[model samples]
Target: MFNWKRSSVIISASVFLLTACGGGGSSSSDTNNNPTPDAELTAQQQALTDIANAVIPVLQNSNNQALSLANAIDAYCDEVAISSANVASTLATAQSTWQAAMTAWQQAEVMNFGPSFDGGNNSIRERIYSWPAKSSCFVDGALVDYDDDTAGFDINSQTPRRIGLDALEYLLYSNDLDHTCSTDSSTTSPTNGAWNIRTDADRSLARCEYAKIVANDVAAQITALLDDWQGAGDNYFQQLSTAGSTSSRYSSATEALNEISDALFYLDTEVKDMKIAEPAGISADCASTSCPETVESTYANQSLANIKANLQGFLAVLNNGMDDLLEDAGQGNIASTMTTDINAAIANIDNFGTTLVASVTGINEADCTNSTSDNRLEEACALHADVKKVTDVLKTDFVTALTLAIPQSAEGDND
Candidate 1:
């Protein structure tokens, strides 16, 4: 499982934008219907409520988008089975919807708690998109098993390595029927005699069928996640919003706040280090000075978009509720600085006209070291620096100001 560190929080500062009520008769400005609560709640309450209201809908959108992707896969599979001329267009539509679902999902990536982290394994979250745990060979084997209707071959029982968005990416985007496995004894090898003998049309049809199975599972996971948030029995929204209450899961409002802040570190470890530094050849993970192969969504070339979506999720938490908390703690200047720094990071990504993989490759390492502005490598490095600015404070003054602890997973690493 990927290190699920980053978390999202939203507490709209709009809560402070209430209509005035003075000793005078009602002015026309009194038209604002919803006023501030008569009894003031702590910042944690407001933040949790706002996050539940804002992010649950994003999760729902992802689920809806997954349904569309599944439908497209079904149509494409049918067309391929009959060798229809519309195969090309149908395949394009399936890829497009998959991209849409991914964008929404990336935006919700910061909400790394509650149902998504059920059983502390991130089972539901990984089922939707298991990155860093990706395995093309396993997906290839599972495809053969699913196509052959091999005994005990069930999509539900398969691990994250063999299904979800990453698996679907391999199926839909890869034209190579050749299996990625190295051994002849592997499931997709000649000895197995299942995958290698298939014609191009048969391979295409089989891949589509397997992709549809994964898509349905992804969609079902999304539904279960949303239900976990809003359902009457296991409602996380109520538990978070009513922190410290008799029936609430959290014993104190600060405890809930700390959980939300822990998630903000996603920018530090995942986006800054894994997404940018390693691919840009700045991290030890890359064998060379630059490794374009390390970039995410390589098949679809959507890595840049994924980073942008991550920043969007981070900003949703920072701007929505954390800003007000900062003001309440007399650290409003830090809030302003964090927002400005995060926006600068987003602006850096926005300037790139190409995918992250393209930006990371074909660069003179010397020019990047000198901070050349015209090349892709320099821009990618700048993005890492920009995000690091927010995270530097996140691990230091931000936590001090909010009285929140850095998550145990995030401790003891200079990078």
Candidate 2:
């Protein structure tokens, strides 16, 4: 969920580039004797090129999903403005569209280097899906101040917390019973009692408008990202596949490999540690018990699905890009082991009895320790251990076999 975002801190590409270039040398005469053909693709180079090619279509599909989500949100907002009677059905459709987009987003998260990592000030990734720092209070304030002309607030001016997928979750799924408009003017505000005394319909309309703005922003940002990656002449995909070329960001094939390999740590740090361990009370952040409120997509009850999507994304990157190279390097066992670990982790998440929130909501905090006999807590602990196995292989054996350096940002993250 929100945990994945923090794991994406930018690493210095120069360090990896220097390491990659250190071992390679050829004299001018040697190069002249055997001028490498422009079209020649070494095993590692070919694997990276193939990965770049494969990612284009995956990103295209994700952009399409984002567009669909934006359209569905707009449609739902339009309907809410007209008739409140079918709000439930319309909201359901909108939520479904959001889920589809979320699925694609989770997949794209695995490939979160390059275009997604803007330097300094602003980040495209944050614009699309800021979480863990989500603030419903900000969303509530935006809705309450929708008509405030002096505030000059629109979705564009809203903070990350107020205008991303999490905000939409709050608007769509929270307190569904009170979502409908009430004719009575004395009803309390759904978000907080201090807000204006508007009818339920008024609140719904405001929330719908905010949701639409957030959806449109997400769609626009994703479209721009896709363009940066695959657009006509300004394509970064070519830059990635052509590492060591003058125009590419990476100075060697191994540098590019390092970037992709570093991305795998997201599964270890964010998914296993922040997403599951913190909530399961196995990590330092959670001192004694499961923290249901820390779970992502809690309002939508889609935390389990998010975890599965993350594993699916990780598997895609490994299978599509690294498997053949690993086999050729005599490290095929590592790939197989990682694949099995990811699959088993997905199964653990699937078998977890209920929604993340429901599973931890009423459990005694004292009984939520890692060794507690509580079935739900125990299952959660087991899932964390399972994911750790995958990370251990990737961070240690995989990096060594490939001769790739772990990104500095990911170093020393013992957990």
Candidate 3:
């Protein structure tokens, strides 16, 4: 289950967007093909609809980007790579490139990392460590140890070690932190020697957990921003609902929006700083020739896992916290300014489905705890275009829309 609070931000905003259209009418842009009703809505409807107009597109792009990136990684993994060194090199390159991207992002912004940005210190254990022996993100009812396609065999079966490795490493933005697969089953259990590229003991699992620490911290940052906005929304609403004149709503909302704007900018800064990097010493061991690559990988996996656990824990907490907030809303604690129609818009976000997230299960491969940097270098690439997309939209388009929807009243007083 995705954290409801975080998820609700989208839903709440989205709901407002949906109902914000002109009173009785549909969008002015709808070529429709099928034109429906037409009439100006109340101030509230206009407001929500305006918000929706700006929000949904951002969500759609960001979510899809993440999914696309995951699928690409899975597709690459399905192709049996040329060799272990090749996989390692690929991992190293990707790791470096992605880190660069993160750095570039952070550098481009003015916010602090792991702090002002997104709770950069929160650790996410469950998010990163997945037991291939027991998990469920697969489409088929049950899954095999590495049987990515239980009933159907695709090109992915031939994937290289690196692709699987990267996916394992970056589970933070890719996998559904909530409702993680229920169990891990495979035709060839890695426990009984099926631990090669398709091992039941994947090392990157630990990396993912480690990354969760960063991701969770980032999520915290997101939640912080959301809270700030909600508070601002409340203030703005208070003025609108009880003021003798329209001045209070305009003034309060303007100030609140300014705070929200800062939060959004900071969120961008935080995300940019989240660097998905390999630990200091990735592979330090490996004198034994008899040691299967899988065994070496397991050692590496464990090592990274230990380093990342603290952060992962916090990630889970962030998710839980947001989920709790959503639960509160479910139990009837929404704002009076919000309408049921708006709620439905928020619900629309749930409609955003995922395939890569559902089709794959955690793969068991190299171990992390005792593996070497040379060995632990295994990598996979997850494109967080979706999350990035939405984040970008929140930063850009939504701001513009909100400004227009909640324009300052001529009679309002700011002092």
The lDDT leader among the candidates is 1
Error of 1 at 64 (Å): 1.5
Model 1, 299: alpha-carbon shift in Å? 0.6
* 332-375: candidate 2 lDDT, tens digit per residue: 77878887777777777767777767765655545445432224
Whichever of 1 and 2 has more lDDT, that candidate is: 1
Candidate 1 lDDT for residue 144 = 80
- Model 1: per-residue Cα lDDT over 27-125, one tens digit each: 111123332332224445665665566566667677788888889898988899899999999999999988888887887777776668665544788
Please report the candidate that would top TM-score against the real structure. 1
The C-alpha stretches of model 2 lying farther than 4 A from their native spots are 1-41, 144-157, 176-194, 362-377
Task: Summarize candidate 3's per-residue lDDT along 214-308 as a digit string, tens digits.
Answer: 23333333334334323455532233222233534333433433432453343232221121111111112323321233221222232212212
The lDDT for every candidate, in the order shown, is 0.73, 0.67, 0.28
- Model 3 residue-pair collision total: 90
lDDT (Cα, 0-100) at 95 in candidate 1: 94
The lDDT of model 3 is 0.28
